[model samples]
Target: MSDDELGSHYTDVPGQRVVAAALRAAYAWSVRDVHRNAAMLEIARMTGVVMEAHGPGRGPVTPLELVGVLRASLGSLLAGVRGRPAELADVVLLDHEGRLTENAYDLVCEHVVPLKDVVGSRPWLPSWTTMHSDQIRQQVFTAMIASTKQDEYVASRRFLVEHPAGDEQELVELKDRAGGVRLAKGGYRDVPEDQLYRAPNGKGWWWPCAECRWPMAVASSGKVRCRYRPHSAVFDLVPGDRPVLRRRDGARRSSPPAGRPAEGAKCVDAGVWRFVVVPGASELRIAAAAEHAGAKVLLWPFLDRFDLLVEAGDEKFSVDVKECLSLSSLIERLRRRRPSARILLPRSCEWQLETLQDALPELAVLTETKFLGQVRSAMRKAR
Candidate 1:
């Protein structure tokens, strides 16, 4: 859905009202129209912003300004949430400050993301990724942070997260990634058609998430992505080929496909495999490297609050490994829960190491290369 239309689901509830107002205010800045409504005007003033009449006026607010307004708006809204059970799924509009609160942040992660039923919902943007659900949320949050950054007048504008250079190339990379272990233990297979939801009109079927088996939407570009985004892998139909589901009689269960998911298959939640599995894989790599380097290493120390705890020579270190697509959101989350463990950004987020160090100068940040080097150095000292 377009940013301007974000608040359509908002209502008169205290928290929702602020979200609606924030969305509208963000939209107003995008369109360069002064939001004359009291709520919007109050938020703008609180954000120290004054809308000026200029151009055709459909541009995004500067990222810094957008961040400021979102912070102020959420603070005001969350104040009214005191003594109330705030469901994370209920939050629509978000900013850094709102995400810093455990309740609000958890709400965003648990429910607000992987925007429901966005399949075939809107024209695809150049920056959109169908690979992982977390990537999708990161892109959405980036767009929200860049509300005034787009030129509404431009038909084909690149978003802040747009990786135009990687578009076709990445889709090519996705070809081999379409199939995965159904629930990471039920065997590996591609998402089958019968398991997918049929479109209401029965023309075409919505794609199922590679991880969750829930229906995924298609974008204008004909790319199939999970509404939940972090599911990550993008998919495309082989064209003219349809999935065929063999029927079953009463009280009869169909035999599972060799490696594919079937309707109503028992398995773990999709999100666990998608978000945790990959990082877990990285953790193994780190653990192997640490052990190979001859240091004593522990996994899931203290019941998984941290990924790895290592004792090398006279030095000891705790590490939390993260492979988040949106460094901005990850940074915001880290600010709230200051981990005693140093953060390790895996190869996937290697590009973000320098930026993260700058953002959190007080925190120790390491890339795979640097971290492995430290492990080796510690091993040598132990020897």
Candidate 2:
């Protein structure tokens, strides 16, 4: 399949590098301490998780059992940064503790890989960003802890998107406000430091998504492109009086124009876009409610390894706030990760209770109404 057809998973070269940087950072994190052997083993076990092969006596897979496979998979995924000792030093990844490396900031600025070269022929595995390294560590740590028992450990699991929310009114409102598609300025390849354009505010100019008005990424080809390709358009940077967006048809516009799709293109599906943002909006609401009710709440706590952690006086809860559009995908991830936190669903996805119960009967799944009630009860009891 064409790279363009595959979406950001392929065409997003900078994103891929960010993924590579994230992996390299993970490599560093795994090897950094006394826990290295355990960490590597857990990673190997997690890597070996095959959805269909999951059953009794299927795993408790050790890293040594799959080191060759894990190494091969990681090496191929990050071939671009291989053997670059100096560059690797410059690429900052999140440590196991969730702190960003001081020197790793803006690591993308130092390296660029070609768009075509980055489109590898491998099945993609979902991974958290570099910023979430600590969260990933926590997940693996939890898994490792569970594995030592020789008993099947499905860490406080839950099924999301078992069905669909009956009432999505609040979600709809939130989507209309902040969930619109956005864009940004990007480059196809690195421009000389002298030639890089700066805005009036002295910040470097980033291309904006024509439809959403969000900043797009500059790519290895030195052309500006949108990470969200459904809003992508064919364009080039015209370096005349100043750098500007020029359509393939030779039309020009002021920078960062928003609320309109690219020439001859339809705006991306609103439903598709809403799935990405509405959950976040719901999370904000949940966090606000917790705070208003006199609790200490952390959103995306510990690099967003878990969604929300709440402490109301003596009571505490770790929550994985979920709003999944696809029940299958949600189930698959839950099965693979087996998070230790309780999974909370917003009003937007209340309908999935039965299916979730059927699949993961032991999971502590709560709807928005029940969750809020629990929070209120916890706060009152604490007080």
Candidate 3:
């Protein structure tokens, strides 16, 4: 056979010229959205977060599995750097399908990051190898500390053990960290140290760096509580799970229809939009579409998951509950409505009220708590 013909046949043979094309394709398309949501839903369900509301489908997790998440998210993002290396595109992908074993840590250290040849003491961003589960947990920890500088549980037990409750020393440390504390080692911190130090599982973290929310490990009177300070660059230093980014105050304003696109923008990289509507079409739909013709199947099937959906009488509150619930019984309910609908997941519960609106409206959304606050205020006003 000719060179071209022989080459084609050889590649088609399995396990010979094996190219991880599927994995590579996944990498290329792996934007932060779903990959991130998948990791969150996976862990939230597993940890039974906030009283196992995610249901029995998610069981308890061991320490090893926690470490795996830290490594995966970090390693994946870092990709092939000597400090954080991995198998597939750098860092392993962990699916929270079961109650993972702690042994997963041993597996990660041995299999995932086999070579610990640290070339320089440079700080690494939380690479993709950073564990997803751990990353989300850390983000939760970070957000908590960011909002409330004192993580009560961790503080009372860990730091308070040393500083004691009502101790002047603890309060002083807390004051310095709301804007983040300056470590003797280097860098100014931003997170609320008091919040992180008091969290339920808050042990290893040091001063809460607002920018990084990583518990900064500080050694002063000669003690390293969080020995993994430098490595925080490689692991879950902070809760990097991007919930949603809020533009700075005064950044947004009322727009008149098709406000402003940008200074100079290209069609292919619409930069901010998912799909663009062709200008003059009343109801635009792509047929043989342009270069980037893609399709999406949003699984939002509104159904009877709406518990106590008082059509009348009860004027308290109601949820436009989408069918992708966190319970097994809800799964059954979804199946009943499977023929007619799909589940709609907001980027987060925070986006619940706005998810149903026009995606292209260019409007700011409120938090879930904000909606609840409105409900409470309305009740008080009525009373």
- lDDT score for residue 229 of model 2: 38
**Candidate scoring better on TM-score of 1 and 2:** 1
Evaluate all candidate structures by whole-model CA lDDT and list the values in order. 0.43, 0.43, 0.24
The lDDT of model 3 is 0.24
> Residues 1-383, candidate 2, lDDT per residue (tens digit)?
23233232222233344344334334434343645655454344333332112333442244443333223332332334323323243333443343333223222212322222323222122123221222222332343234333112211111011101111343234334532211111101222122234544444444445543334444334455443333446456554334566565454443433221122212211121223223555676787888888888875655446788899778888998776533543554577567778998777567777787788887888887787777788889987
- Model 3: per-residue Cα lDDT over 1-383, one tens digit each: 23233223221211110111111112222222435554443333323221122123331253234334433443333332232222323324332422211222212211211011211111221211221221222322332234333333233212211211122344465635533421111112232221222223433223322212223222222221221121122212222221111222323442111111111211111100001111101011111111012221111112112211111112433333231112222232333333221222322323333433343133233333443444445544645
By the lDDT metric, which is better: model 2 or model 3?
A: 2
Q: How many clashing pairs in candidate 3? A: 59
TM-score versus the correct structure, for each prediction: 0.39, 0.34, 0.19
Runs of candidate 1 with Cα error greater than 4 angstroms are 1-265
Cα RMSD for candidates in order: 18.4, 19.5, 23.2
lDDT (C-alpha) at residue 30 in model 1: 29
**Best candidate, TM-score:** 1
